[model samples]
Target: MDTPSSSARVCGERPFYDLHAEAYDLIINDPVKPWCDAVDAQLARSSSILDAGCGTGRHAAEMIARGHVVDLADAAPRLLAQAAARCPSARTQLIDICLLPTADHDAVMCRGVLNDMVSDGERAAAIASLARSLRAGGKLFLDVREAEASRERADGEPRTRSGFTSRTTWDNGLLRVRETYAMGGDVVEYQFTMRPWSVGSLTGLLRDNGLRNVSVGGGVGRRTPDRLFVVAF
Candidate 1:
């Protein structure tokens, strides 16, 4: 298996989560209740859950609230600190998803994180690591956007939030997103590059990593039509 080097090579060791840790919770206010409900339906009350790549403990908070033993892990330390603050009772750690510590979990969730890995090797390593973190019958839950739809939407127009303006374009067959933050005349620029995945490709990749019983469905709770929600055992 290959070690994950995309974060370092493309956007430093911690990537966007660490860079924007302070603004993450504020910027990402999308209601996670529905997504949590969907995942909750798949898990037992006492399941040992590992929220791998959990950013600021959104899902972890829900699981912990439901009386599950949830461990929150992320590659970004600042983000992990935020997760720790949000869910003080649950264990929080700074961990790379592609190099997770060996532990038997009843279910492991890698939500909205795998696409951050810019290369196939990094994505593969992350999946394999998730497999290793699971117990014999443990299941894995993940969600990602459809490549074609993402490309079309991104290329369609520019968008802005707060003081940040972003536009997506194609570069060398990869999606390149350029974001500029206006900070009182001093503008800061950031770029993110990602490769999109199809449902078939994602399902195959999970199975290739020894994750069986793979299934893909509409995005969690059917809120997002363009997203692909994946479940595997």
Candidate 2:
């Protein structure tokens, strides 16, 4: 494990992903079958789908196998590369969700990405961008951590997985996460902050971005207890 330099440490989001990309699947491993089931239930056959912020392309690969046209996009280059490798038939772009193309997809699926937008302005821009990326009648499927549930679980316990140990703490409205990777004789640490969303605030944001007919449910798959899954068109 090699630690990031001081400059890399300054920007937590990108650096954390860069360092964790190789072990991301192992550390954050959760079943994608339930998510695919949710997508199948909502989206029509052969729909053009954009897996915005698609980390490692697990869901996008499943969508492609299910006869959908899938595109993978992520701000992190390493993550995007991994996703592209997993889904060679899908177009891959190293772009942020806020900078995605408009009206280019029949549906957009963004999972666990909105929480990374710590500021209100960033969150608004990202959601508006997702809405703009859809064609008329296109749907947006997204999920974020529920504020209360996340707070309850943010006990700062050090949990180890795939040779990485992580701890999370809740502060006001933000989650302070710290991770350490141990390998050989080296130990590397990374830290970042995430903001959970309230139902009222998230619903209002979706409606404000011109997305209508919002449907909110429990988190998909293993995330049901601590997350909120939403669909809007």
* Best model per TM-score: 2
Query: lDDT of model 1 at residue 55?
Result: 81
What tens-digit string does per-residue lDDT give for candidate 2 at 1-233?
03332212332354346765677787667898898999888888999999998888999999999999999988777878899999999998777677677766889999988888777777777888899999988999997899999999999999886788889999998999998888555678878788899988998998998886898889988733889889998
Worst 10 residues of 1 by lDDT: 7-16
TM-score per model over all chains: 0.89, 0.91
lDDT of each: 0.76, 0.82
Q: How many residue pairs clash in each candidate?
A: 0, 0
What lDDT score goes with residue 8 in model 2?
A: 23
lDDT of 1: 0.76
